[model samples]
Target: MAEKTGNAFDLNLFKRLLKFTRPYKLVFYFVAIAAILLSGLAVVRPLILQNIIDRAIIPKEEELLLYFVSLMLVALVAEVIFQFLFVYFANWLGQHVIRDIRIKLFNHMVGFKKQYFDKSAVGRLVTRAVSDIETIASIFSEGLFMIISDLLKMIVILGYMFYQSWRLTLFVLLVLPLILYATRVFQKKMKAAFEEVRTQVSNLNSFVQERITGMKIVQLFTREEKEYTNFKQINEKHKKGWIRTVWYNSIFFPIAEMSSSITIGLIVWFGGLQAAQGGVITLGIVVAFIELSQMLFRPLRQIADKFNTLQMGMVAANRVFAILDTKSAIQNNGTIKLEQVEGNIQFNNVRFSYIEAEEVLKGVTMNVNAGETIAIVGATGAGKSTIVNLLSRFYEINSGSILIDGTDIKDIELKSLRSHIALVLQDVFLFADTILNNITLGDPSISEEDVKQAAKEIGIHDFIMSLPNNYLYNVKERGAMLSSGQRQLISFLRAYVTNPGVLILDEATSSVDSYSEQLIQQATEKITEGRTSIVIAHRLATIRNADKIIVMDAGQIVEQGNHQELLQIEGGYYRNLYEVQFVSGIE
Candidate 1:
């Protein structure tokens, strides 16, 4: 089970949740009208029964009997019609409300900073998006209407019962105080149990997602048994949550039923004595009163059940609001567009840290001419990739000014800055989509020929063409259907088509094999021509031919020169990396 740490109910959150339904106000009113009509019909039915017994059925007056029978039938049919209308409108309103909420939440979440993803689990977010929304939707559609109907029914029934006989009504209403007290206590307990259920379900969802996404790793490590055991433990916790929920419901219902029976028995004994004492109430009125008492309790039972459902829905609403309320760490200027640029980049006294204890890049400064290829090479964690991230503004510098064409990057609009740079990473991620759509990123304006040319430039044109469907071939989630090398080639093609002024290749060719690497090397050369590029590679030979090589270590620049000049130094970090590369039999 996912750990239950956060509170779900806040008035401000509920207010926001209600705003999502404001658009469907008219339909909600229609549903409310239907419920009111239905409640009134329920009250009239018992009185109609009392009338039929005293005036029609007992006296054997055929005309009165037929008239009363017709009235009862009309009421019954009207009740059914209103019930359908009530359900239909509520369902319509609920679906649209949830749809609005999900869209708003989704848009908000995607805009959140990288730090949010770093802190929260993917599985938990997925639950908020999918399962939590579903639960809330159900509650809005059915639970809300049922509660309204039950409450209205309870009021109407009690009012009529009291008018009939105040003494007996008081006796029946006496049990209600105790029921209300028990309901309050049980509701608190039920809410806690339901909260646990929500947590466990989220945890189970995370576990399943982790296992499925990392199935290859699990199989390779032979940890299936361990995963199974962990899953079983979480499943048991989930079961216990359900068990508590059931225990509460089971005990509460029987107690409610017993209390209801006590109320009914009291009415029967007291009403019989009144009838025996030459009271105005008839036997039929007594019978109707008995039925009316049952009617009162029936709606009460439904109200209780609906109340539980409302609690669950509120929990889900709280979670959904929690996500919507989160502020993205990466702030963007209000501007919508950025001016065109020549792509001259500068970093002045830049320092950055992903964590407090360790700085990734420290006191680094560099300048890139409009169209120069700057290759960054060093051992892993030497701040090479960190420089790429900083340049792209994925992570803001702790202290520094990164300027594009002399304008501080912070001043330039975020989307505009990103549009100028196309980043191709080593770990390629692809959605389940056609190759063409993946390359174009669902932009319908891009021509098919352009996509193909980009693929050919990346030297993956032949591989794609060899497939029966060619560019129409579907790539599975994360490109599971394609090899790592093929996915990388597709990503390279995607960046090529964008034709951005600044290109970033962060270990871009690291995952491909030797044969694929050679093709990538040639393709990289073609694509990097006349484009400002930052290449972060462990392969020293890949960057040896660049215009400049920047060697970084411990967030600081330790060496800066052409590869040949760095190689001339016998003992520098670049020289040592170069020696290791050549000794490892890499070209």
Candidate 2:
């Protein structure tokens, strides 16, 4: 969330945004030059009109009329060309700036710690990357350059009006102060409204995205009407936010129109009186003043609107910069590199907490030698999954140390540390891509032949070959096209292909069918071969053959032994857990 700056134009934010445009300054300079030319050309038409009326037509000089008309036509053609360049290059620069920003924003998000994502909404982040950035582009395309051009035109027109007749020019500007005051008020109110609208858009997007992704759960729980009611509440907020902006627009534009009419009326009355007195004002002067008044006030009216665009863009930039400014707590300061690790692991008095003052891992220490299979059995929320997260350094631990082959895991580069370890979680997530791509993860070094060989080694090659397109079969979104069992097999093949020095299976087969369980068990045997492995499971049968079993209770290790060796204890936590699971057939 971004804090409100309350100013109509945030100068600091604007300067920061201007930094992204530096790479395309050549195009932007061309746009600025075009706007300058267009502003100068805009006043030529009215000057030519005044000359035609007073000098050429009234004096009956046909040749002078033809000459002035030709010049006017030439000015019009040049104005049109400049206008085209202004629009084209302005938009071109805007698109390129947004492209660079979107990439930077995405790359920043990719490096954010997992804890940041745990609290942030996915759809909100997407909105920032997509819609909010689009609004920023409009600041260039329809806001900044246009406002500058309009301001320049107004200044030139005002200068021309004064040169023609200072008395009439003063009359036309009599109502200007009132319009300026009203515009100031409108800008402040509209800035707040646009900010509210952007916030509601993010909220609406988040709610809709969450509901759609979890639609199956909603339907299973018969929450259709309930969810709809919630959606309507959020949608209503979104509507009200825009309506507020619309209301401000409605009030301000009418005030501007009435003010313009009053100025024109003043010009007519004063000019008419001056003419009646002693030919002090001409008909040509009055006509040209009318045109000049419109040209002057129209951009003033539109400046208010374009300022709205500028403010919205500033608001969006503030939000995006807030994200970019967020520093991830998980710093990767290690420089140590290893071609291969021996797979010995240790947790020395490790302690952790997802939230402050409520520890999840409490001074639990463990060790595993090379090529040893360790099973961790614990009740739900006993910090089983937290161990895997800490091991991978997805979240920083509060105290104590985790070591791999006598090297502090923190002392090793994150990429080097994780590359030697593989994790196969309980819920397998596959991208909307081919089976081969999911298995190889687009790693060109791991070719099709490598994937097939690994899958065959894990006993899933036959199952994949039976599919419609075999290795090329598309998994669709989140692997929706495949069964949970089939997705699990793919995950197994994915892990096997990596051939990591250490493997961690966090309830990998706990939710699969009996047949899938049998296949996964076989895959597990091949994957854990000659590697250090940690299996976290609720089913006691899965870890029956583990070299050592560590029983956990309330975030602390209570028992450690092989399965049979621990099951023989009369009332040990492991034995009781085994009996309960065996009797309930949860194994």
Candidate 3:
């Protein structure tokens, strides 16, 4: 929930991130060892060059010169070997750590309560799962280990400079103030810039994802220009955030480069003057100091950039951990496992709401024996859908209990409870996959033959056969290849294949044509036989044959009876509803 991490370096968040490396500790240790070895090797090259210049080139001893040259070659080869190990293992450790974190994050998200998803953006979640996690990987590869290696190199270089000549080392120290001040200011500013950039990236993703998903609404309403303008504004904000970091980099690097150059120039000037005046300074010392100054300054420059990477990883970790810390999952404390669930259901004074102080289902009570079909009918917002939602335990009731058979639903395990129930909604969602896969939903027990048999039983086999590849035909996303009525049929067949003990259809036949309606009617009759079924319908005529019709108004059951038995009551709710639907012929 924090807008940003604590500072450029948040040790707490960094430690939390490093926890992912516990599973790969061997790789972590190897990368650490390689960093130390590379630091040792780094000092060798500069020292060899200094020895070669003063001992071999200046003294004119052929055999000593050859001996020093060969030693320099060996040092160069060793440096290459350790450098390769350091880079490769650091990256390898990063990738493994991120893989473990990504999987754990996704698994945690899957268990969150449905209300959490209802209030959150899918695109924002995608950013956390995909791009933000990718950023955290750099904490290992380029941020942590890389920065450690560079700092070790700088330490060795500074130590060497002091040993060679304390005077030249003091000259190098003069430029440190300017460079250090610039680095401090740069890190603070760049950390803020990267935070802004991450926020804007998440916004950009959310805007694009929503607009693309609802493209039909935009074009149908002829608001494409308005949406395009909105997108441009979001994209511009994202660009500005990134450009601010670029602006900081452009200013900081030049100052660092200038400081480095000034230090080298000062080294040569001071060393040569002292050497001319019969001091300890020599030509080899001057040359070696020049090389050592770059060696120290280059890593200092890289550490700033790597620290920027580390800061970004921290920001991303803070955001990702916010979601992972949410405790909105439904409490599943039931230890009772249902080997079989009878279809009896009862709601005893159930009260609930999606939002606080705005009750949707108010003190409702209902009961149904096993193997009965009940139809619920009401105007919109009459808690028709809420009843079924509670029965399935999708939302916990504010007060009272829902019982499946005789046991409280909260006492039954969730998987075992849901396995006996199948829900078909008016809005059917199908993945972009084959018709067979959509029906079976890749359930290992439901084979292709099972799907075909289910389709035949539901009487939609011929319709599926009319498609290009029959059951193998691709339905595209959300079943876009199928008409609304055809999608309803697929949903019915999907429910049928499950062989659930209780089937609840919510407004399933309200939007279909007469021909599809007839097919659905036949399928419903076949599927609901000998199973407890609850049908919520807007078209009052469809449920005339229900064993019991429960009339609900606002949030309570107003009437309950057989269709004709309720129709006999004078000026009753169901009586008026039935007349209104048949007289107007529209719902």
Please give each candidate's TM-score: 0.96, 0.97, 0.97
lDDT of 3 by residue, 146-263 (tens): 8999989888888888998998999999998888889889999999999999999999999999999899999999999999999999999999999999999999999999999999
User: Over the stretch 1-587, how does candidate 1's per-residue lDDT look in tens digits?
Assistant: 11233343345555666788788888878888888888888877788888888888889888998898899899889888888888888888888988888898898997777767887889999999998998887676767788888888889988888788888888888898878877777778878988899999999999999899999999999999999999999999999999999999898899889988998898889888888787976766787888888888887777777777877888888788778778764677726455566779899999888788577877899988888888887767888877877777777789989988888888777878888888999999998988888899977767899988777766778989987699998987988889888888888888889888899999998778877787788779888988888888887768888888988877778888898899898799988887777977764
**Candidate 3 runs further than 4 Å off:** 1-3
lDDT winner between 1 and 3, please give it: 3
Ranking by lDDT: 2, 3, 1
lDDT of all predictions: 0.83, 0.91, 0.89
Off by over 4 Å in 2: 273-280, 583-586
Score candidate 1 by lDDT.
0.83
Number of colliding residue pairs in model 2? 0
Clashes of each: 1, 0, 0
User: Candidate 1's error at 109, in angstroms?
Assistant: 0.9
Model 2 agreement with the true structure over 1-587: per-residue lDDT tens digits? 34559999987788888999999889989999888888888789999888988889989999999999999999888888889889989989888988898899988888777899999999999999999998889889988999999999989998988899999989888888989999999999999999999999999999999999899999999999999999999999999999999999999999999999999899889887876675768877888899889999999998999999988888888888888788875788889986897899999999999899999999989999999999999999999999989999999999999999999999999889989989999899999999999988977789999999888888989999999999999999999999999999998888889889999999998889999998999999999999999999988888999999998888899899998899888889998887787877755
Candidate 1, pairs of clashing residues: 362-555
Error of 2 at 263 (Å): 1.7
